[model samples]
Target: MSAALDQPAAVRLSLADALRSARETRALLVGPGVLGETGRLFREQFPGRRAVVVADPETRTVAADAVAAALAAAGIGTEPMYLFPGAGLYAEFGYVTRLEASLCRHDAIPVAVGSGTINDLAKLAAHRTGREGYLCVATAASMDGYTAFGASITHEGAKQTFNCPAPRAVVADLDVIRRAPDWLTAAGYADLSAKLTAGADWILADALGAEPIEPRAWAIVQGGLRAALADPAGARAGRIEAIGPLVEGLMLGGFAMQWTKSSRPASGAEHQFSHLWDMEHHVHGGEAPSHGFKVGVATLAVTRFYEAVLACDFERLDVAAAVAAWPAPETEEAAVRRMFAGTDFIATAVTETRAKHPAPAELSAQLERLRRDWPALRRRLQAQLLPAAEIERRLALAGAPTAPEAIGIPPARLRSAFRRAYHIRRRFTVLDLAVRTGQLERLLDAAFGAAPASTAP
Candidate 1:
């Protein structure tokens, strides 16, 4: 019965720190072979609750027996593990419904023995299906959803995030993660790298007096992002020293989302690209790309957009004419439908586009704001970007897809995705900036021209 995070020298996001700093998540136990005692850990964190283990066929092999055995050792009451059907499960509404149906009242607290998909199901089932808080035994250094409050699930042919709490506690066994797919580790590297650009978008939102970024949450995640992403090769290699921070850093991103109650701190325009792909699915040959890999390429695209923006002299731009020329709602609606054609995502696209499309009055106000604050905003945006070359170098080292082509997205689709992405969420990203200022076409040219070479490992 050891507490993994208690070891000072061996820990990155210590259990004490997780308990203290994370807004909703209670405890964290991350160490070599720590998952062997998941049952005891669960009992300590959520005593008197009937523990129900949930896993898929593959995840069960990872830790089901160990958790069941540990619960037995702890003399805690438990039900057999509820095995979900999956070769690999997609987080969609249907699957969430199935998970909800699988549970019973006897399952008071859930212990999810997997990564993104399983953890998302667990948290959603807890919130949406009337179960109390749950815990996670992470199996990979994959996406950051484990500690995040929002579940990114595909619903009605669209990728939508549902608000939920982070896992009550999280346990990551280094031994288990070292055995995970190399692509998963690489995806984690790519996902963590989105923070710099995401922060910049948040700053833009703040400037517009739209959705302002929270300073406290911003510092916690961004403060450690560089160290987290610095050793991408080591992380991909699954070295304990290198991989440990990768895990902690991803967890911190989740915590930031929880503090903000929104994924803005960790997701920006890059995530919208992933959502666009999820919306069509057929465009990617009906195979979903890893969220992290997609975002990595998208981050490179968005970083380039910021570069284009910073290079331009806003003083020369005709703000008055641009505001006058801002597309009417119906005009953009037609464009949205046209771009998202051959997919069910068209309806949602139209809805979000119209909702976020600025009216002339609002457009005029925003133009005045942008014109007045252009220089200061440009400086902040530039300060937040990592050199585009550096971003690609790190992604290449980690064996992640560096471009849309690497993830099975063609140039036409990627360009279309860029245009349609701002409509996916109302967030004011560089995409919105370009669109509002009549520079979207120029930004699109740069994104596609300097695309990162595919570097899949």
Candidate 2:
């Protein structure tokens, strides 16, 4: 629909306009010297600013030093904040308190020096303290929250989504991203990959009036996926040239939803799956994996699961037959709870939601339409992601883990993770689709037996 910003200047204005139409124009500047370019842009965008560099200990010792040196060289006074390490951890209320205290302590204007959590926390802090700031260096290409005007933080030990202001400017340093753990990059790729499942879900939501879609925003998202998939090496390297577009695409994706004050553009079955996994991990005293990692596998599962559903000749069944085929609540409950054991809220949300809104007739109708249109949608998706096999191969090339077990999950745990995963978040995703269709159990059985093909371009 739309080409990503700076997607080869010669790639046709219609395409460029298409992409831009969907997203607010974000400033994406790339150069061999990103620090200087970014610093210059920062001054140009908002002048007369005192700077606070909110960084993780590792980044502060490494990337933040260079950022400080660059700002100082540019004659800007800078302050340093050695933030606590880890993703999601940095955005905690406690961390926010520490940062608020630090802001007052140094009278610093918040500017983050790391990516993902650091950027999110800094952005939140800036929103709270009314400061202007940007990201310096980091990995975490996984989550779409980076550029969105919202933050998912833990409140009272439960993961909650909070309204957050978008960054005044975002400065992503590719050098740091490429060198960081491969899981982070792979997670980022997985996040991008989930767009299809999300896109499909978004389409269904819009069709049923559950959500609205903007053609312009959809185009930009489509274009961004194309650019990311087209350049495999650049994605792995985290260089400015490669990462600039990725960050831009993510920003556009976030904006597509943010501008509309909705999340339909960037979430779907895969996100639900990821959220469930997140909850399960928390419940079992298990470590959390990257958002992208969970979404990646979830995306694959949803795609295959849906494809199988489409293959079923539903027209042959009468309404009574379909009704009888619906999954029982006890079965659904047990599966969901077992799948998402660690997170009570997630399991409860999913189980309760299905109980309240049983829409098998509607779900069946939509499945019919989806089956008829599956070919077109599949072509469109393939045009963007290639095949599922290629996506798996690319993930492997990046040294990113693929299956649940790859990320330190045991087989039984993963099975449970899949079953209960739908309960973690409030979103209309493929997991929801399976739940609504009364086919989740059979799908789970198949999942354990046959690894589905990739849906990536």
Candidate 3:
């Protein structure tokens, strides 16, 4: 692929260049008709091991027969770990247990044959069993959690990210993706857009000495996100041509975490919002929406937040006082229950420690340092961040939800999500900044509107 094709080309090929420079992978291939050769790939990659194909029941019915025929023709044994129907099913503990049992029963090496949840289950199971895992990506929608070094799954009914390795190689058969629901493809594009704001948040963290910048990996996320958002059809049909870059970009996003040993590069305010929504789904007894769908809405909110910041005279930003009045224990606990739905003792302890010592003064000094370095920081972001307009435009083209209302979330929920979201994860993100500064309510009001505006798309 062209270097510029990996990220937003208008922003320069910096992200693409970075990814090319940092990648340590077997390979990633996306083509219109690559599914038929699955058996060959398994044989070449693992000469003697049995191949276990893990997928959801719907996908199994749609694609399993073809895969099985190929395996049988190649004289390779195939095992299917059919998941429950629908999103978030792959992460449920029962599903994990069943898959584990299947793997143990067959002594199988897994090949996840579906997108999202199926991939996560195989990766996590492989990690636990120390078996090699591979993925045949079924869609080009959004770029995240694909080639990453972890599995974001639900354990005991709560979301958690567990350590794992990227697939041996990611094979995206674009033909399969074209047949997926348009919403899935759009969700993928939205997930890729989050990279713009996510990259900015990482830059801020690095500037504050909280995180380190890996230019090469950052470049992957930057380029991949930019490129995916730039394609007009990426917002629409989620075509094969678009899939190549989107898949490449998302794979690189996950790989960047491998390089950084952290998720700082691809997570920011948008992610927190998605996490809040994910928990709410679990709490209210509903299927969790696709990660990209929630993230698309959150990305727009962050973009609007940054835009507002750009318009403001932040010179008068009350950094110290903002941090001083940070949440107390009762408030923190309440926020956690509301946003995260539940909290374990470790999270509670961390909240209490931070609550007792609101480091606003220390953080305030850091902001001054950031202000002094804003010029360089701005340059870095300019090279990577997507403008809010472009992000919304791309999402609209993909026919994905670009606002809270599109996802059945109430306008009040958006505001509440912002206030309580920081407690969902101990990580410091844009939401933390908004809450500390007491600007969250205003920010949400601006992004989603005063009323839910049920018209949000």
Candidate 4:
């Protein structure tokens, strides 16, 4: 993989080349007026298949009606639209089940007509009904699940990524997306910003041999990221020039995830914070916070963690002593139980922690590798990450909440999340690195001013 990375940079791919590289998605039309061409694109991608428009009450007004009319004009057969309530809609299993029931009654392909929540619900529902794929008419420059495989839905009180194919086609009309509420676009910008930390996490994992970076996947997500993120102020103000790249960046992330067959290409520890909050049902202002907002705050937190890790002198580390001090399997399990004591997700947490928990021998080997690779790894990570203050600046300029309290997470709770989030996923990230080296608590103290109560047994 490093050999591939060392090769001369490939020319940026055209949209056609990108679509071909994706595992499932076949067509993408993104422009100011592409919403009007949805029927034509759908016909080109799914000839002779009837269609059903899936949306909520608000989106029905936003684009669903126009989509239905477009299909009719194109002579495509259409089923009655399946409308979820505009309010209280979420990506949860019950909603998926309801949408599945509606989809099961028709043989038509679902044309999802909203952003993150609607797309996820329709993607999972269509997959459940044995449909080859669905069409996504994006209404906002929100999160990047549009052309990505799988759906992030809450099931059994935990946020889990259910295995499913992405939409066969996607249509993002910049005119519609630009008209979306400012915060929605801001959220999209922040979500895209998280790729910085995510990329750094991937570099760390690659160095540790936990997960090696795939060159193609890395290129797809990272190539246009900085340019896309360059004008957060313009994006927040709904400028097409800024929103265009923001949408493109978000879409490219999905394509990278498609190429990799995993979200590792686009997600890392920052995403874990969002997932942990989802499982906890954390709410602000009487509603669950938007995914991008949670992730924006988490990205800053993780960036600070990276700063601490980067400052460490790994060359002087005592690998033998660290291995000897590593927690036993049972001790780790007990700590996980303590961290999740009142939640129904304790079992899930325990299972995930145990899956990635390294034994003494394995810890020694991994630590030795880290010690050996520290210099090169540190340089790579430094190249990939932005300063925490700079990330906060971009996020604020984009109109996203810059602090945890802005999204309803108190400082103490956020501190606790630094630990709890680690146990919820088997993914190897900076959090895992900190824990293995006995630096997590110290990192937390530095990032949060003081560490919260320990969950350690």
Best by TM-score: 4
- The estimated TM-scores of all candidates read 0.88, 0.78, 0.81, 0.94
Write model 3 residue lDDT over 1-457, tens digit each, in one string: 1233223323434333434433333555556777777777777767877877777666776665566676677888766654556654657656766777667776666767677877777778777776766555454444477777777888876677787777766666777766777777788778878887887776655665655566656655664465566675743665667766776676667667767767777788788888766655523224566788888888887787776544444456666666676666566555455543454433653463355334556667766665565555555555556678877777888788876776767656766666555665656666655555567666666665664555221
Give per-residue lDDT, candidate 4, residue 20.
77
Judged by lDDT against the true structure, how good is candidate 2?
Answer: 0.58
| Clash count, one per candidate | 0, 21, 12, 0
lDDT of each: 0.78, 0.58, 0.65, 0.88
lDDT comparison, 2 vs 3, better candidate: 3
Q: Decide which is better by lDDT, 1 or 4.
A: 4
RMSD of 4: 2.2
- Tell me the lDDT of candidate 4: 0.88
Q: Largest lDDT belongs to which candidate?
A: 4
Local error of candidate 2 at residue 227 (angstroms): 3.1
**TM-score of candidate 3 versus the correct structure, residues matched by position:** 0.81
Error of 3 at 268 (Å): 1.1
* TM-score for predicted model 1 compared with the true structure: 0.88
User: Looking at candidate 3, what is the lDDT of residue 430?
Assistant: 62
Q: Which parts of model 2 are misplaced by more than 4 Å?
A: 1-26, 80-91, 105-107, 132-142, 206-212, 231-234, 237-245, 283-286, 315-317, 323-343, 346-386, 412-419, 424-426, 450-457
